[model samples]
Target: MIKKIKKLKKIRLHREGTDTLVYGFIVIAAIALLLWRFIDSKVPFWCFTAIMGTVYCIVINFFRCPIRFFPEEDTTGLVVAPADGRVVVIEEVDEDVYFHERRIMVSIFMSLFNVHANWFPVDGKVKTVAHHDGNFHKAWLPKASEENEHADVVITTPEGTDILCRQIAGAVARRIVTYAKQGEDCYIDEHLGFIKFGSRVDVYLPLGTEICIKMGQLTTGNGTIIAKLK
Candidate 1:
């Protein structure tokens, strides 16, 4: 009963400022048809309408923000997935920004059709937030972690375990939004931020952390448990 209420309270529409784009496209489609009827008689009306309809559908789904349910039990050491997507990369890598040591890197790749909302992986205090400007490379590439523009958010657990989550911009994704701030307390599965379009998020877990998801496995933001802390 309590979980249901919490889920209902968390249900929300996509972030503000996106309505303008949705309505703008609809308006443009209307004007386009009017102009086409008067100017371009050779162009088929059905073709234009179909193209516009397809674009509108895609745009609407891209900005979808669905309500998610957090775990009802204790989440002390559990790390939930921060975004909805497929696990693309999982390996050990040297993290230079915060950990400056070897850690397990679990990467989730968000496609245009996936929900881009991000959430906190665990209950902790925000330790640091940093942004880096770099080339917008394809997010799936291994080099994109360092070469692509990204933002890093590090949160320290009550036991002093620091987990790092990074938002990476892809070739098509130009903006990365991060709501986490240094010195703020964050709860597991709580809303952290969002990525506008196709992108990727990397979570650096401490060595020997038990990873639950496998590569290519689909994950739901705030609903899927990714790992368990030591």
Candidate 2:
């Protein structure tokens, strides 16, 4: 059990091997170039410049990456925010593909510095998981939620009520990772997946669910109460 907990925390760390590899490659290449220059021309200035530049890039990327997760308690009848970001939009939107009807849409915009992990909004069984190929637009752009490349995961709680959560790619985000699949048992606060860098998450709630958050409000994934079950 302790090992599992440690593994979970490790997964939540945003800077994995990919970030390390990228940073290492740039730093190593810069160092190598500087060494060659110093060996051939006795120019020590180039080495310092390369090392500083590489360090700066590594620091910026490491600090800006975001990681998040959801609560583990049963969230039946409650609507939890899926990502950490500012609430950008809340309106009635037609969602024909999954809900097959008009639903209340709550869109959260995640900046590059915000946590990019997505969480299950309710304790339930994964009813459907769909991925759509589309364009990558600015995350806060009005149409990005509907038009950008995204993946939708719908969960049906014990009461048989449906909750839809989507991870949408932003201008800076190129990939959406999801772990939930249809019929999979998922608990509230489970780490469903993550969005690389900046992105947005659109949560579709049943009409009449009281939205506790307003536009511009900052929320934490797995921690914030987005709305109460009606």
Candidate 3:
């Protein structure tokens, strides 16, 4: 019960951001101290301090990794969202790179303020994890799905359904971290990876899969159902 209660907390700092937050705080503190000692004008010191403090607050918010899980006990045939953001796309596209056929693509675009941590979208065994080096495009654009640097994790469900989860780097994002390993089992509650800064996640479902989300709708990672596999 105690663990569950803690998991239900509103906010928690992710370990991935520990170094960043600690270093940011130190750097900001040093700058503020320098200003206070060297500058005679109190107004400029306070103004600089206030601005930098707010900027660090925004960075803290960006690194937040809220504990989340699908509320239901049964997860069979259900595909949960992998990241928190707005559903920027829901369309059927030809996925030539992996599937070599048509698939339904559902994309969630995370802004700098959203949690950068990613979660496994399904309960399955990871088929493979692939990372591609490419240009960083704006994540919301369609071309970003292919042109942007991304990490792909493919999982085969217990029922033998294959799903592709891709994490795309955005214009501001430089790193894509993927934790899912080949042949490893993954669950909806387990984190798949973390993307630094702004980015997006794309889930490719097999043709005929029923999508539960709509374009422009906000989705909570590990909580919102992305689709129902047939």
Candidate 4:
């Protein structure tokens, strides 16, 4: 019974848009079958039905829905990675837009196949939530971190630590979702929002914080510790 429950949970994850290729193939196959049946048979009624069904499946699978989650656990001091992707950059940079100071910037680049969920990196009260309208460059491009359409979330921990997380839209990703708003109490590893399709997540940590992961490392949402405040 225990093993069965675990299997069920795994099935749920796979069904929730995580296996995008499998779902895409299924949709394409259904559309092909419908087209063959109606267009070849000269069934006018079936042709209309098939066209609608094909369009519905394409829209629903591509943009209407996405899979997101956050592990329910106490995550304080430790910085949780906000998205599943490869760590592209981890360096000290001057943040002029929001924090107005130097910080350790950790950027994760998500491909089309990655889980797009974004999670809070620390338990804190949201201090600010800002969205900027900008260009949609390739997500992995270095300049995309600052110039791309994105949403910024700043959280102030009980200990007075300031943590910042950003959801950046790529050339293929046009939507950025953020659930954390100013003054809301956000727990670490809690579900904050999501980014549709390929994108990137940038986490800015205050100076003096020790980073746990290195450049080129792969991280999962709420599972990989990006850093810890000293």
Candidate 5:
């Protein structure tokens, strides 16, 4: 049981955006230089530079991974939000792929402005880690949960409850990076994975779990308590 581990409050840029940031800056700089050096009008150069600069800053914000910790001491029956986003769904549905039973599915849809880093939602041992290739759909849609390219990570909590966290790819999201490994113990505050660009994360829990979030509510990954298990 991971009772009370270390806490880090500082926010840092995620390394996954390193290459993209570097290349984006270079290309933007090159274009700005050409506009300044070859074009006579200063208006176009300044306008283009400003627009690209704002876009780059937005991209940087997308990759910002904050070091957050679950504040409570006891983790039993606690389930945290796996990603920072607005809750798009909260309902009971039949989970066919794994549980095959009726379960509460809470889905969070991350937009381009939200953080893309994901965190483990509970103290548990990973039961399974699998990725499926599928179509890229708009993440907020219900069908995107299973139809989109995604990674499934099922963790068995210390209390013997199995929790499934699915990372689904949005139409703009092309990559899904999962860090959970089967049979390995995972705890809250540890990164579960990162989704490049915008995406969605769905957490499937057994029916009767007390949900702490409502639809359209904003959630902070690793910080927002999503539910309480039985």
Candidate 6:
């Protein structure tokens, strides 16, 4: 039991290698500014310290990685939340890219304060992964899902149901990192990707599937059950 708990608690740094480079540059620049302020004494020490401190706090929080536990029983029909955010959209829409049919689109808009780590919504094998280059529109906008830069990952369950999840880049979010590879088997609640800064994620479910969440509701990634497959 102890070992099982330990394994569940294991955490991973999403985009750690890239993040390290960013952190190193930010810290070094801040320190250099502080040193310069100290030597010159032209600007008030407190003001400089406060400004740099706030910047570091926000940057650190943006890259935070939290542990997520999977459901204890089999997750065949369970659809978990893929990202931490508030439900922004819940409607039936025509999905042209992958499905070429109508699907129920559930979108979660993430703020800077929310965890940016993404998780797989169900147990499945990745069918395809595609990335698009586009404008940086605000993620909460309905058009962002189709217009903004994003990555789409389609997963097929053992029962042969197709689920499509997309990671979208917001005005402040410039990067979308996806870990999904075609033909790779993925588990529910497992790490899927990360979006730098604030963004959103869209999940396309087949019509007639039970929707468990409502509009404007907040969701905790991997912890909140979004829906159930038929």
Taking all chains together, each candidate's TM-score versus the true structure is 0.91, 0.79, 0.95, 0.75, 0.97, 0.89
Predicted candidate 6 versus true structure: per-residue lDDT over 65-167, tens digit per residue: 8887864566768899999999999999999988999999999999998879999998889999999999999999999999999999999987899999999
lDDT top scorer: 5
Off by over 4 Å in 6: 1-6, 10-13, 17-43
Tens digits of per-residue lDDT, candidate 1, 91-210, equal 999998777899999999999988888998888899999999999999999999999999999999887899999999999998888999999988865678887779999999999999
Q: Residue 23 lDDT in model 3?
A: 94
Candidate 2: where is the Cα deviation over 4 Å? 1-12, 15-29, 32-74
- Considering summed lDDT, which 10 consecutive residues are worst modelled in model 3? 1-10
Model 3 lDDT tens row, 1-230: 01121245356898889999999999989988998999898887899889998999999999998887567777889999999999999999999887899999999999998999999999889998999999998999999999999999999999999899999999999999999999888787889999999999999999889899888999999989989999
Give lDDT: candidate 2, residue 196: 80
Q: What is the C-alpha lDDT of each candidate?
A: 0.85, 0.76, 0.91, 0.77, 0.94, 0.86
Clashes of 6: 0
Q: List the residue pairs that clash in candidate 6.
A: none
Better candidate number, 3 or 4, judged by lDDT: 3
Model 5 TM-score, 2 decimals = 0.97
Local error of candidate 6 at 125, Å?
0.2
Q: Indicate the residue-level lDDT of 186 in model 6.
A: 86
Model 5 spans > 4 angstroms off: none
Please rank every candidate by lDDT, starting with the best.
Answer: 5, 3, 6, 1, 4, 2
lDDT of 2: 0.76
Candidate 2 positional error at 130, Å: 1.2
Task: Write the residue-wise lDDT of candidate 5 on 1-230 in tens digits.
Answer: 64666676989999899999999999999999999999999999999989999999999999998998788888789999999999999999999888899999999999999999999998989999999999998999989998899999999998899999999999999999999999999989899999999999999999999999898899999989999998
Which residue ranges in model 1 land beyond 4 Å of their true spot? 1-5, 9-12, 16-20, 40-43
Ranking by TM-score: 5, 3, 1, 6, 2, 4
- Looking at candidate 6, the ten consecutive residues that score lowest on lDDT are 1-10
**Clash counts for the predictions, in order:** 0, 3, 0, 0, 0, 0
- Give the winner by lDDT: 1 or 4: 1
